[model samples]
Target: MNICVFLSAADLDERYTRPARALGELIGRGGHTLVWGGSDTGLMKVVADGAHETGGRLVGISVEFLRGFARTGADELVVATDLAERKALLLARSDAVLVLAGGLGTLDEVTEILELRKHGLHDKPVVLLNTAGFYDGLTQQLRRMEAEGFLPVPLDTLVHVADEPADALAYLERLPTAPQVR
Candidate 1:
């Protein structure tokens, strides 16, 4: 599977890095690909390193402005003209999306993906890796959206909330778009 991970570019606590590393390792060991923003710093680098070390393929989608910081030696690196194009390319190139602990940018990417899924634009599985309950508040807000009729589709159907890296990968692997396990 080509798993697109949207995550932080900032240096975070070990709480976040640990799960990111585990997820990347899982992706690599499973013979999957890591498709993500091309940044080579912080959690992005940590996960990419994990993937690379474990023999997983790397496909990076970076913006023109951020090209300087993009990961080197990626299996494939594509620089988009802008953020919108980058996001579109990232989604188009992946089988599933994993939202890790990140800041506003991570939220933005996940929101756009969810909106697209809600409108039936795509059926790719979306997993929110709730590391250290980082996303508990957001999940609650999402649930409220469902209850308030703000979301046309059930929140559960829209996104899977995972407490651990393994759980995240397991959920994605179970989805229809993922490769059939032998």
Candidate 2:
């Protein structure tokens, strides 16, 4: 499987680093390809590094505008012109999406993917690596949307939460066999 992980390039704290690294390793060992933001800093770098260390095929998609500030080079990176283009390319090339702990940027990426899935733009699974209950509020908001009828998507369609990297990868592997999509 090809997994596209969404995470912030700013938060490189231990709280976010451990899981991102572990998850990347697990994804690589599990024989999955990794697609991620091309930046070589912060949590994004952690993930890419882990995957690359484990010998996983690493593919990066970065926005052209952020190329310099991001300090990510295209000699080894697959660069896109903008965020929208980058996201579309990632979504199109991946089999799943894993969201790690991040700030507003991460939230935006997750929400955008969710909305896209809702409209049948993609059928891939989206998994949230909820390390230390980081996404509790977001999960609650999603439930609220379902309750208020503002969200037409089934809970199963929106997100899958995992407490650890292993569990997250397991959930992803089992997604296609689950009865929900069928």
Candidate 3:
């Protein structure tokens, strides 16, 4: 499967470093393709490196302006004209989306996917890796939204949460046989 990973462009928090690395390695060893922002920095670089080390196929999508920062090891590099295009291409190509611990930019990517799913834009599985409680606040806020009747559907119908990389893969493996509730 082609897995899209949304993560911090910079490793601002140390807690996520190891998980990011492990996730990348897991993706590679599992023979999954990685679709990500075309940059070799932060958690992005760590994941890319880990995947590359295990011979995982890497497909990077980014704006032409960021070409210099692109990961040299990517098997296929695509430079979109802009961020919107990048996101669109990423979403269209990925079989599933895995969100790792990240900052504002990561939050933006996560929201983009979640909002689209909420509207029935896509049925792809969206998994959030809640490492070290990185997404605790956001998860709470989402549940709060469902509780307050602001969300038209239950939060569980929109996204899945995994505590680790292995759990995330397990969720994906279960996706096919799992009943569709949406």
* Number of clashing pairs per prediction, in order: 0, 0, 0
User: What pairs collide in candidate 3?
Assistant: none
Say which prediction, candidate 1 or candidate 3, comes out ahead on lDDT: 1
Candidate 3 weakest lDDT stretch, 10 residues: 173-182
lDDT of 2 by residue, 51-107 (tens): 877867777888887776443432246679878888898888788899998888788
Model 3 over residues 46-133: C-alpha lDDT tens digits? Answer: 8898888886789998779888888886898899988888889999988899999887878988999999999999988899999998
Judging by TM-score, tell me the better candidate of 2 and 3. 3
Tell me the tens digit of each residue's lDDT in model 1 across 40-69. Answer: 999999999999999899999999999999
Better of 2 and 3 by lDDT: 3
Candidate 1, TM-score vs. the true structure?
A: 0.97
Clashing pairs in model 1, backbone N/Cα/C closer than 3 A: none
**Cα lDDT over the full model 2:** 0.82
lDDT of each: 0.93, 0.82, 0.87
| TM-scores, each model vs. reference | 0.97, 0.90, 0.93
